[model samples]
Target: MKYVQLFFIFLVTAITLRAQTIPYLQRQGTATQLIVEGKPFLMRGGELGNSSASSLAYMEPIWPKLEAMHLNTVLAPVYWDLIEPEEGKFDFSLVDGLLKDARAHDMKLVLLWFGTWKNSMSCYAPLWVKRDLKRFPRAKSAEGVSQEILTPFDDRNRDADVRAFQQLMRHLKEQDGQDHTVVMVQVENEIGMLPSARDHCAAATKAYRQPVPAELMRYLTQHKKELIPELQQHWQANGGKTSGTWEEVFGKSLATDELFMAWHYARYVEAVTAAGKAEYPLPMYLNAALPREGKQPGEYPSAGPLPHLLDVWRAGTPSIDFLSPDFYNPRFQYWNDLYTRSGNPLFIPEIRFETGDEAKAFYAVGHYDALGFSPFSIESTDHPAEEPLGKSYDVLDQLAPQILAKQGSDQLDGVLLDKDALEQQITMGGYVFTVKHDFTLGWSPGAQEEQWPLAGGLILQTGPDDFIVAGTGLVVTFAPVKGNDLIGIGRIDEGEYIDGKWTPGRNLNGDQSHQGRHLRIPVGDFGIQHLTLYRYR
Candidate 1:
């Protein structure tokens, strides 16, 4: 009996170790794929509160909520001030608590290092560092007035950040390293200097006067056609020089100055990340504060990893994996389109948790091929089941396995319908569809013209002749793609979500089923349906 128990213990230990290990991040086509526990893992994560872990008393109540939301990973901020109140002394109780609780809940974590910047401010720096301006100076505006941003030129700031980050990494390696609770680390939380396009400090001035780095210039020249649209347009309209100083090459404008600041800031954070990765090399990424097109530098958050500064950031920082976007705007597709250029993976770390916009989540996961999407303040909702956002997440959780399998393949498509936009069309697996608003052909004519009903749709092709269409507020009609003829084989109604298992629902084979190519749910509500078809002459 003792020998048998010992053998079982050894088997369990080996399996645990194998489940915790992960490899460095690499690019798979246009997407950044992470190898976790010997499998290709896509991050489906949410950003927790910045100070949520400081006291488990606060975080304990929210554990059950997160787990129920079907979140695989959580993005939590680790403040430098709280972790290292003094210069060299480091405290990691908060980080330890986060790791232990995350593991207990069977969730992975992405630690956001709130070091040099947090939302374009140095508010997260240690009190001692923030108090002593001489040791760790702040950036100044063009008028020589100090701003809340930490100067990238300050060696003391960089050293303190590196030391704190290294200690955090070492602790993670020792404690959760074997279990791999933490999969990735974000170097800094939106590092940027705002309220001014360029710093007027002496050190900043000196650096700005220097010529543009040869590597960055080469990248710009080589990839000019693929540059950020606004930047490329500016350069092309201004002679498009391949070699010169920053002003001479990119043109002397507020946009150019902001790009210059981004280069310096990215370089500084890269150094900090490199120091930490030396101890335990894991995948690391950076987050950016996006800006509007016609907005000025100060009008919007500036000096971050916006697309126009992609060249500077790519050339300045190679240690980071990819730059992610935090969404607070309505133009989800447009912003993601800009960020995904040059083969960058799309990862939305934050978005508004509005009940009406639930369908956007589906579009992000299915249509856009985003690695992950998290709606901010996820725990704040009092009744998740009743909320549209929560219900959408529930459906997504049900379909996660299918979605994961078809992530890189062309087997899925999603749509987000607005009140003004009443129709959407998509093609998958040799079938073309024209899906309209549920009220398009039925109900009162005024209903279709009234406020748009918020709805989402997802189509998955199981086989060449089989498909499943699921969601709300949709009227689907299918036709063959080009030369092939499609005939309806049968319809599966009374969809069964069997014990969290998706099997074929009961067949609705009668007059209820149309001639196979056309089916309509006149008054469509929240539901899932499977339509099986056959190819014939």
Candidate 2:
């Protein structure tokens, strides 16, 4: 009997250890949370510049800067050309060095695989692959001129990428599997076709004339009601044929050309992703370079994972966890709303890395229940500690516990304020909150400026009468949702969370709360305030 008990205990211990080593995504309430080491982790992350992670000695000073900035995760690339220099030879010294440094600094990493494609060019491919044109053909333009991108129609190109990626994953599992310093991986960097919507290479041209795959047609028909408006409208406009060639089914326009290319690109990426996941399953995603407004297909890198091609990518790449946008264009909110369709979790892997990102971070986590957020070229700042983003990150680190708990719940809300869009109304805990940009107040220093700097913050209801508001540049007033009763401020305490505990510093009233008219965190300041409210007739 004692021997039986010991055997059971050993079995349970081994199972738990295996579960704790792999990081994965899980659904929490209405949001999808990345579970690491058996707990939910919010990534306050930044992506290093393209060439930053190529050398360990060059990255020594950069680590301290990242630590000072309060970043918990670093998004660095693992270049294919460097990792696999020769046909079948592999080198993992760069990857190993990155893992060791990140672990030493107590930071997590999201590895970006700069594999077959980077920004629609095959510049990252190994020399052998690039030089052997006969063995591995390049995609051609409409005029039959060869371009730099490898044709996805070739089996050799896809197999080569799969072998390299599988090796990388296998190495990570054998080397750092227990520590799990790496949380997630991006499959490629901004994959898309350049200067043309569809490849005009001989293989591509021949494939384009073949009948559309039955699998994709089935997906569209099965998900007809749920397809994005653009894709659905295009299909319906062209008669929604069940059996026909790419041009015959989707019409002979540039839109159809883009659709054809999108399907092939997704399939190629899926092959690589699936192979890596088989070696070591981690949450994997793809990022898209958003197209500029009014640009037709072929004008920009076409048929990459943009919003319109999401359906095609989804149908092709079941191994890809989700699709994300790399922000270099305008319309932040517009793009975010589109990306979060059909319960897809939001994780911004790359943004412009500017002044207003602090606010967007708050709004993204609070408003959309985003899994994580990151900025591009994160090591460019001169003063890492004094940066506005650093200050914002410090507060976020303190509030991460509460933020993670309240995500996907009505108790949390965030607001982004700018000159044109000054005010937003939020209803929580039976009270209506009127949140506005700090510049809306005439007495503020930058109120009269021609362009107002962006201001934003978040509010979390802790109790029926208690709430916490944290952010920069904002004034808030509250009113009851039901009755026509006046809401009075019982007390407002300016405070900070130390060790996940609220430490109040000042009882803000009179002048601090604008003589009880409103609660304000000035434009230049980043802080947290705990407030208690009461109702009066």
Q: Give the number of the best model, judged by TM-score.
A: 2
- lDDT per residue, candidate 2, 233-314, as tens digits? 9999989898899978999999999999999999999999999999999999999999899998888888988888889999
Q: The CA-based lDDT of model 2 is what?
A: 0.91
lDDT of candidates 1 onward, in order: 0.75, 0.91
List clash counts for every candidate, in order.
1, 0
Candidate 1 lDDT score at position 347: 77
Roughly what TM-score does model 1 have, to 2 decimal places? 0.90
Cα RMSD, each candidate? 3.3, 2.0
Off by over 4 Å in 2: 1-21
Range of the 10 consecutive residues with the lowest summed lDDT in candidate 1: 515-524
Tens-digit lDDT string for candidate 1 (226-254): 77777678777668887677788778888
By lDDT, the best candidate is 2
Task: Estimate the overall C-alpha local distance difference test score of candidate 1.
Answer: 0.75
- In model 1, where do residues sit more than 4 Å from their true spots? 1-20, 23-30, 42-44, 441-450, 484-489, 494-501, 506-527, 535-537
Angstrom error at residue 518, model 1: 5.1
